[model samples]
Target chain A: MYGMISTWRMAYEGVVNQFERLKEGEFAGNVLEASIREIEDFENFISVGYGGLPNEEGKLQLDAAYMNGSTFEIGAVAGMEDIKNPISVARLLSQDRFNIFRVGDGAKKFAESEGFLSENLLTDYSKNKWEERLKKVENEELTPYDGHDTVGTVVLDKDKNIVSGTSSSGLFMKKKGRIGDSPLPGSGFYADSDIGGATATGLGEDLMKGILSYEVVRRMGMGLSPMDAAQTSLKDFEEKLERKYGKVGAMSLVCMNNKGEWGIATNVDFTFVVATNEQEPTIYTSKRTEDGETVIEKAAAEWVEEYLSNVLTRQE
Target chain B: MYGMISTWRMAYEGVVNQFERLKEGEFAGNVLEASIREIEDFENFISVGYGGLPNEEGKLQLDAAYMNGSTFEIGAVAGMEDIKNPISVARLLSQDRFNIFRVGDGAKKFAESEGFLSENLLTDYSKNKWEERLKKVENEELTPYDGHDTVGTVVLDKDKNIVSGTSSSGLFMKKKGRIGDSPLPGSGFYADSDIGGATATGLGEDLMKGILSYEVVRRMGMGLSPMDAAQTSLKDFEEKLERKYGKVGAMSLVCMNNKGEWGIATNVDFTFVVATNEQEPTIYTSKRTEDGETVIEKAAAEWVEEYLSNVLTRQE
Candidate 1:
């Protein structure tokens, strides 16, 4: 279970295809690694990889983190420049216990030592977007494609070892030195073999505040099913933020329990693709209740129960 | 409950004293804001305030976040420069609901608009440290003081409201724009009025990954005592990291419940000062257990059980 880090329904298929490949044993080792690398290589998804949105200065900076639940070891990089596939770099970096994290020029230099290639991540589409954003930026005008929505994925391999990860160009026009939830373990992603795995998208800061993924996996460990965990965590987070910030930022979470139950929750009606078995990937859309009691938005208390019984369970 | 944002045991007095002032009606509103300002203005602490350490480029880049638990409203600034009291800037920023977070040059610009004074945060001591660090950095030398250990504070005010926040100079020579858990919510600090509040110090990255403070408070909401919650969260985090990385980073948590119960937990033997109405700022030194069970670095689980049974019972 994962997200385009956090994109619309239309962007889900590409990754869903990657999931399908994984299901077919197209490759070995960590499929999450392959999945994210493919997404990063896919330039059409500008929020991550080869053509991820650049920082405020128009320099493409990347952030990625990966965790292997079996070992619970993690590796991360932030503000990593020049690396075409940060998830790959993160995977490689995770190999050594000496330094599981790196950033900036140091990360670039390390990638070179490890024989990783470097490239210009900005494509014509991203560059044009940047240029267009520059024009409106000074005037504080906003764009829907703020160069963003992270690309995060979590795969529960056949061994039932749940590995979770997320990589992003980060929010559009973020500060040159800004680091989001992407590379921070537990904040952006978390996986525990005894419990489950979770990956988050949407406002990185809010995700950080909720420590959403870790919280989900922990809740699952404490016995809440994946669906219950996602709904409760999102509802609680929204309430926590609502009292102070009026309206909460848009964010979402995806989860997979050890039992194989899967779920997604968000502050808005959000969509994610699931490739369970030979089925062509189906987009699951979760809508919050009108009373705002459950998960995404101000969800209703009974929404997830209804949604799961009426919608998700049927899909499974 | 509070922390020096991870300061020296002695420095804890200053903030504890400020808490006393608040108790005696020596000031108005949250004293956390004032206490942090005092710490930031103090030149002795290299991790925060006027004499805080600089980035690799030898510029002081600061990060801070403040939250009023009563409202659950949060405000933060990252990579902010030329500000002596970043916590102050964060405090002022928290007033306007328009923006809950900001960063870098944009943060500086916002601080200016808010009439916060600008000053170089570098001191000769910090400059000398950075210079020596530069000499050894090429050799990849390591030091315990990476110029970070946030000065986090959380106050359960007379009204029993929880307000928590943190400020930092960031890790020594961190990537030019690197951000630690200091300015982000949940990781650096967290407070919820009904349950309790928490603040952390030590390895900011590790703290962020665990989001220990919020987790602790949430555990309290789940019915664990303050000490129990802190110990369990820290242990779980350490175990999780140990499985993947062999050893864990240095970090600690301080917490308080609405019942006026307080506690501190760490992976190392740590001490913090506490003062309440009748208490004269007693220093509590929590010793870690050999097998790592208690609150405060390898603490004896039995110790917390006794303390909670004695102190917390009286508080209520």
Candidate 2:
């Protein structure tokens, strides 16, 4: 999805609407949880949200991370299984430090203490344990793990402050022990309300090694347009991984100058949608491939108009 | 395969070798045709010189382009189906006008005038057309048309001269009336002995639209390594396609200075080997997936070495 930022008036309006039906404190929790849950539920083949391909081992092991650039607050988890919604946990952890939750057995214990069902399993593996198991199973028939591509958002408020969140299982069908860019601090998720906010999706290991976030931030600082900078970074990644070809794919969306502009670029052909208060959700893909010839400009115009309309309607 | 230069010595040696086996001036036509036939039989993946893939309509269409940078000579053809060996025809065309061989029905007449087999069908589509009524009645479906991917070669000889050639049937299962990058001057194959050379692989339409070959050449002029420039140009193709997370596999081999130093990059994890008189055939791929973790160094080393050894041994 394209970068999203609701103006102060837009967010305040949502808050006002929520206050009419619920208590003030409940609104923040509801909206955040709702947004995060949506991340968990995203199931499109193109988008990098939840329920995507498994790890190389073929099992669903979820991981996620998020950061509120405004407060310089962050949250993340590496190996969470039996958790239906990981983005929720990440959001909780990024909340007030007093309310920040720890993961692992303690996290499960806390969830149970709060009456959320927590499964009991003796064989759950931490990142370290998973690494050891990977060595042992190097020559064996290893099961694939879940590493769904990530879906994330960075919202710029009217004051131009920003909050960004990321959610993913990781690469689909990854190895049992593999950890992708998702849980890494700056690699998987980072945002700054002052200038702009960005989110990335693709091969996590490469992204982590490249320190991609810093590069994106650096480019943004140099005053390149969001689209040009994002596309340029993606091109760099392509050059680095040329010999591996299709083994990697990535997409990122960025909002700059308080949502005066935004950008989305990806390696493969797929759809990305953007929604804002002033526009209708607009969907964009390179060009729809039905029989083969690319319909280039037709698809672009449809997306731009639809997106603008969606944003306009949301203003009410 | 990365860029290669069959030295002027190698070409002369091959021609002389063929000449030695023939009686002086007795069958000069047969000798030259047989020599060209050698390259026609080199490889078979539907993308190589002869018998390439057909278009979606099951019609056989072929495109070929060749340039000898040393001589500043070039030849190209498109939508010709009856030519038995297009490369040979192209080579003849590039030589003195007296060497030009008539093709299609005219070629058959010329062959008969020269007492060679004049009735052999050059394309399956041509054979099918003769039996059109019977073909429609036949319940069995014929193999569907799959247009060829562009196959190209660039050679720098001992004289520091360059030669490049490309041939393709077009895209696999493509729409009718589609032409590929093979016949394009810069998109498919290009070489300049003073600078460098490159050949492209993947969907020709995407490459042409992106002006990939020109981009690579321009980047090389800016001091980027030949391999890096090729990869950067390919990345431009990917972004143009909006492939956020899919493979658009391609490979390009490039050489810089005449020190024979070269670089190769591909989107797939396949070994590309090359042989040199100074070094054994070397094989290389940038990354390999092993037990879930991708190993970059080992993949590159082994592939380069193996391929180089093979190519060198074959040359010997």
Candidate 3:
């Protein structure tokens, strides 16, 4: 009943893997930032988060928030810049009892806790080069549009518990002190295992006004499938904004209860990549071509197929 | 059982009121645009579908879409700017059967058919000064954070059937040709009265990825209260994004089912305003702040009090 590498399917892959791993306690209390960091694409994601769209002043500022539904706890930091790995701080908050404020402080604390020689190692030379570039570009001509670019994730356990979180450097380049939905809970990410979960990207304030995630989950509870739920939530939100505030942009999610059901809806045509159990993950792009709702399904379907195939062969 | 203005709520209000009015045959297809145009705070909500954010050249570019779940039909337009009311075109498509395209001449033809006079309103000196000033700025610099706006609605009739819709202009002063969640079905809005209905706002991409509305409806079918369902969806979506994206942002939602049981949930620290038949419409400017979750009881209680007071006075 479920095998489509559409946007929704890719998201389901991520969610299912997280849940499967969680069942084995492989991701205890630290699902917020344990991405496959060694992957180059993951690094690119960090760049998108940190050096992405700027704020009004073109200065780089950052904000992020995370929550683990398994524990019903969350942590966030706002208006920070020049710090690498905001997600790491969120991870620490999810794992450790102490609250870490600034990214610098969080890194120091984490290094000390992990017994690393220098906290700066987290920002190694290449990462520092990005930081240096951030400093130089702080004074660039800033525009209101630059304030964007963020990331987030959601995970559901086998027991049907769901958790979601997000991180972002506010906009592209920006005013010194600007805050978007990144640190905000529902606007950035909202999860309910019994129903589903959601995460957002793009314009924060616009989504916040509608309470995007909450709407998606509520609809799912009524019986819509995960994909339909996501689509409807966004449709309603956009309609209202057009009638009221006008300008807005963003992307995110709503995932169904843990039977590996989920959906991905986007305002703009974009691609969402995915990988599955022991598979070399690939990206899937969803856009409207000549035909309505043109979806490039199974671009990455082979990943899961190959992995499962290998397992079957080994058993044989 | 709710009060607080979120983009999601605004969207719900639009679709709910319009669909109801439309089903009652309040106006011919053309008049639906005027109806949506009359919503309170119309100017600010440029993101959904009306007078949206401008393109790189500083001219407003708009995108919008609509769907009828009952018929499984859809309509959309993209890259439309300087059009006063895009919803009118979308509603036209929803009401009538015709060839539809995502913007360009097709949408223009529809608008012209509906008597939409595009007379370069931006250059008119008598127009609102802020709008004129906004026109002076280049669109590339426009950001999505200009306003807390979004409008959508979903409604169910006595037959237990449902319909939902959304609209948005995208972020203010945005780059040329930037489209948000408004035009994408499911990402923008979703409704299935047989299952349930939901609307969303904030972070268009995020809502799309998670399929927020579909998830909520499914959960409702599982028998969770509307409020719980909404909260659970938000929680789960947020947790997922936090794991990959890091920083999170705000989003809000309003949902209802066949029984008219409505639920509201948000990750924002407040800013979600709600109004229902049982309660007077009220606004929430702050979250509980204790746990960062929305506190609707206070606002809901106040609404109840005001409603009850009015009822008793009338009886006396």
Candidate 4:
């Protein structure tokens, strides 16, 4: 019962592209990496990979992580620069028992030494967007922070090995060297082949405050269904954050148990992609109900088309 | 009840220095910061702050984090260089709602912009130690990585406000920009004013795989005694790591519940300092038993004297 789930509409094509290989019995880690690399290579996905938005300093610093559930091996790079595929670097680092999490220039140097290509990551589209946002921020016309849609995924293979990964350029126009939950274990992603795996996408600062991804997976381990775990953890943490911190930002989580059952929860209008042995890759929209539950349904054909087209047109 | 517990015998003086202010009703965050700052200023402690060991590049890179249990606010810095008080920077960052975690040069810049004085963190003693280790590592007589003792602390003030903080130079001779669990939330430290707080010190690479600190605090929240929580969480994670990753590293944890009760667990001979309204600041040594329980005893006068003298002599 192979299965995969990922945050955001941007992951739909990547999931679709990888389903065939996964069905052919590809390892969860490889399939997860390939799926994320697809999103990373696409220039239209402004929140991840090559063309992602730059920091306040106009540099494209990336953050990514990969975790092996069976071994509990994790590797990550935060504030990495000039690396075409941060996810691959993270995957490589996971093989080491020490210094698995590297940051900044050191991360870049490690990737380069490991033969990962160092390319100029800033595309004109993202640069223009950054410049435009910088003006508005200077004029106080808009807040400097927004658009942190991290691409996070969890995969379970035919042999039941599970893996979770996340990649992001972090918040648009964020402070230099600022990193979100994308590169953090437990907060951004957690996986255990024996139970399930979970990944999160949202305002990383607030998300890290709750370690929502790990909580979702932990709840699943405690006998809750994947859906119940996702929804209940999100609801509880969101309420706790609101009461304590006075405000809560956007948070969405996706999870899949070892049996290939999947779940999702979100506090805003959100979209995700999922594929399983019994189902083809599909796009779904989700929202939180007033009753502290999640409402998820297959997105309409038109809505899917519009979303994909919007992503493409943004490249202009 | 005002209480504080910090990892390592090095923290004894700092805990003693701050107990009076804590008893006088200083806020938990302020007391935690002040206590940690005292440790950071002490040059005798080789694993943290001033005179801390350097990375392979012969540069002192520091990591630190602060969390407010009441507000669930977190701030961290990783791979920062030339910073005198990383704990203070982390505490200041906890007040921000975004971009609270910074790394490398960006973290250094943030601290400088905040008016933190920039001083050379490396001392002659530390530099000489690094040089000697470099030769031994080159001769293949020793592994490049060792000595990762982070000063982690948890404080419960008179008002029951809780806070957790950690500071470290990371693994001695670690790669440049390598970070341990010290700056990462949940792995290094976790706090909830209504429940408890926990902090970790050891091989961060292994500690992060289990997220033990957060798990310990979560167990305490689930109604376990602090001792039970610490022992069970560490024991479980250590065994899991051994099975899955082939081996586990030396790990030690210190936790304090909001009621001022404290607990400790360690896979190695470890020492920590604690002070509460009912007890004066005192140092204790702890180790895990074969039966998965912790054995803690007050440090012998001879052992304490020898330890302090050893630290002082190392500076020569």
Candidate 5:
């Protein structure tokens, strides 16, 4: 089943709205790139692309990754700045005959040579957000949350091929030169003909601690449903972290099999968007049972509205 | 069933020699720490510790990671310099009560506060290595080999716990702030009480593209022997890369199940060491048959002699 999904609803909406382009026979890669372009341009999400938060040094160092599943080719950049759409730059790097990966200034130079326009990604809103935190920090500051959230989209194309892309400004006030799972190939997302596709959002430090996405995908390969794979991996992730920090550790994942079956899993109750050929885009909220099982429920719009602005902000 | 293994013979020898200390009932953590202390001080293995390779700027930047299997805790540092024993520093970060991760100056500051001594890790040999690469640049340097080889050791202790540590200088002449699988918990290594333990070497870029170590460990959980897990991962790694580059990519792995059954796999032909209670220290060579299957052979002393200085020097 051909479909697309993202960590944020707006991001998924931006892509699914472009589903008309697929009807017009546009390339899958172009749709994937255009999707993140929407998130990069969206002002509401403060965790990815332009207007996203900055590092401790007050610089918006971005990391972006894109993978072409049929070809098993990948492109990524870490600490790249100035480019408006890093996912496209990542695509350029992967498609270019000369290189598959570049970093920092070299990546920027490569993007420029490939005709990507350079611009400062920081916007007034993000600047204010960072400034507010700094002001909140008195002579002594409280430990802030790992506020890094990424824009990840996994699409299973008409041919059942999966392509995925991820972009992030990374942890709020994360260390300078810090590169998270966003730009890493397997840690952030993965897909194959043998398995399906999977992507993650949350504490990358925690997600990167285990197979995360691939664990779910390979479990799918082992005949577990996408939801079961995701739940199993999350169970392990929780057990791994709960020992030290009680119930702390943030991560949520979505999985899609080539058969067009998709399942969702998350440690906390949160909603993600789903788009497919037979249905309008809908939201699913994943909740954990008291017995430590994952449950997926269709989220009411009113509940989603409250969850996004209120519940998510508290998490940040 | 409790044991430790490393890439370098000298490193493994250091830990196995401490069998007496185990008999005297020393903590496994202390024994694991002491094992890596030898590698940290060894002058050979230019990819690790002091005198290792430098970044493009001619400054030595190091990456190290440590994991406690029993607690499922992980600590890592990337691009840290002026530290002789980054593996131990990683251990300190994991053991600390207040912090789980710190990077760049914050990590350096924390290390200093934790009483870690700072000194230039670059050695004359490493300095010359960087200079030579720059001088050898012709018109423009070609895409160099992956060139990243790390020091990873997995220890299974008396209580059947696993603790692993990886330390590296990353790729020869890599980007100034580039971080690789060495510091990533899953991409480079992963362990679970049910799944067993695994670690990797060579070309982190390739290994991180898949859930290399975790894939191996998960296969072990599925009833595959440690050797089968390693072989399956390496095969998939080769198939994935071969499709794109036609016989390009580099990686090696070691896997040890909770049962103390262990195996080694690599894309390139090389030998690694192993030692346990029932066996003397043995060097095993991984040779591929004409059908491209990996088979282990007892490496002769004479063949090992030429392979090390000849093959390893060429790889460097």
Candidate 6:
């Protein structure tokens, strides 16, 4: 069976667009890359790729990673700028045995040398948002960080291969050269073709503390259902963080076992997209119950429409 | 109990120098930082800090990480240049709640903002070595990558607070902005106050594929002896990598439990420094047996003398 699961409502269209190729027995890596590229190229997705928000220095530095479960080959880039498709670059780097992880100017140089387009990625919409946020921080004592919706996807192919990828501009108005979990292995993403794969989107600083993605995948490997793996890992880690660090930030994870079964867990109202051989491409929203379980439901028509309108009508 | 274990014989002096403070019941974080800082300051140690080798562009980019086991606070820097003590910078970053991991220019800026000294770290010895290596690569087509002896240390204080830190110059002649496992949590180092902590040194690319540091700590938490945890994790990962990735790189790990028990494992003849309440600070060499267990013995006086002479007598 073939299936794909990704974080956020922004991934719904990409999953829908890529389902045909996945059903046609394409490799998991190619399908995952193509799906993420669609989101990266869309200017409306302010948290990833082309029009993603800038750092405190007004530079669009992106972080992305790709992991091939079958080979344990991982590639990643962080603090990269002017790279049109960070996900594609990460996938290309995964083919190399060394220097697979690059950062800052080195990442930019490698991407450009390898023929990935280097262009100005900052759109006016994002720039205006940065400016407005900067003013509020100066005048209102507000925090300058928000909007870290990373596009993380995990795919299982007909050949039983699993691959996971993640792309993010990181926390909006973050310090220069700041990176999140998007580019980290085990924390941001983990996959093992024989068992399953998992990807995360949330406060990267807190996420890396538990290596939650790897935990989810490991639990699945140990006979836990995908849903149980995702929920228990997230809940346990969050509680541990609260007791230790005195606070916890938002966190959401998505996982899929080799059987095309998928699961999700989140502390906030999080939307995700999933499609499988037994299920149509669909968007779902998830929230944590009081008992620390996750409640997942299909996105209502009204909610989907409202989300789309918000993206389409967003302005400075 | 108080204890410290560090990769490489290069750390012996630091461990020796810091044992007094550790015995006095200093906090684990302070002792770990001070011990690593001593290594970072020693220009004779070519693999880390002041005399560390340069990247392909003749730039000295360094990587380091700091983790507090009790709070699960992690801070790291990769591809950072001109910072005298990256371990100190990492420790300082761990105190923050966000943007704890910085790379490249951002790391430098953070270091400078925090009053970390900014100065040329490339010594004449390191520069001449880089030039000589460049000639050998051009003349003989030899791989320019070597000398990745990261100084990774794990310390447990009297209060059962565990802290782990790592510092490295990365692979000699690596690509600009290339980073290994040194700065990434879970892969390079992992610590838990109640259980144990582990740190790695070797081919970071291969090491990261296994997330071996975290695996060692997890095994210890599961009630394995420190030796069993370190040996089994390294052996299992090396075999798995050989099967999947076709080859394994030289890798070594050092770990310490809260009870001051320490263990070590390596595919090569690896030397490490350890001091604990039960054992005096001493250097030991370890190698893997045919059966995949580790054989560790106190380093001989002749071997220690030769190692020091080799460092002191090297000339251009």
Q: Please tell me which predicted candidate would have the highest DockQ against the true structure.
A: 4
> Per-residue lDDT tens digits of candidate 3, residues B131-224?
6545544354543344424565554544444555555655454433334455545556655544566767665545544557666766786898
What would the DockQ be for model 2? 0.01
lDDT of each model, Cα atoms only?
Answer: 0.70, 0.45, 0.50, 0.92, 0.72, 0.92
Of the candidates numbered 1 and 3, which has the greater DockQ value?
1
lDDT of 3 by residue, A1-316 (tens): 1111212222334444443455464542343354411111233233234323333334344556566554435555454444455555555554532232222223334434554333122223224444544665655533234334455565554444566666665554332343455554456666555555666666654555455666666678778887888877787667655653444455555354445566777765555543323333345556544533536454456655654465334321
Estimate, for each residue in A117-231, the C-alpha lDDT of model 1 and write its tens digit: 8777898777877887888877777643334477767676555677788788887777555567777677788887667788888776566656788888888998998878988
Model 2 scores what on Cα lDDT? 0.45
Which pairs of residues collide in model 5?
A: B3-B156
Give a tens-digit lDDT track for model 2, residues B36-88. 34434433333443444544445455556565544434444444454555555
Instruction: Write model 1 residue lDDT over B1-316, tens digit each, in one string.
Output: 2222223343464676586666765422257888777778877666787778787788888889887777766678877889887887787766753434666666787788778878777888788878888889877776424446677776766666777888888887875565677776777788888888888887776676577888898899999998889889898888877775566877878887877677678876665655555455555566577876653333245754665555323321
Model 4 chain B poorest ten-residue lDDT run: B307-316
> How does chain B score by TM in each prediction?
0.86, 0.61, 0.71, 0.98, 0.89, 0.97
Q: B232 in model 1: Cα distance from truth in Å?
A: 2.5
How much is the lDDT of residue B119 in candidate 6?
94
After superposition, the stretches of candidate 2 with alpha carbons farther than 4 Å from their true spots are: A1-33, A39-58, A96-116, A119-147, A241-257, A287-316, B1-316
* Candidate 5: CAPRI quality band: acceptable
Candidates, DockQ: 0.17, 0.01, 0.02, 0.86, 0.26, 0.84
Could you tell me which 10 consecutive residues in candidate 6 chain A have the lowest summed lDDT?
A: A307-316
Off by over 4 Å in 3: A1-316, B1-35, B40-52, B95-101, B104-106, B113-115, B121-144, B269-290, B297-316
Candidate 2 residue-wise lDDT, A59-149, digit = tens? 4455665666555455554445556566666666555322231223333333445455544221223233345446655756553332234
In model 6, what lDDT does residue B143 have? 87
| Candidate 2: residue B263 Cα off by (Å) | 33
DockQ of 4: 0.86
User: Model 4 over residues B49-75: C-alpha lDDT tens digits?
Assistant: 999989999999999999999999999
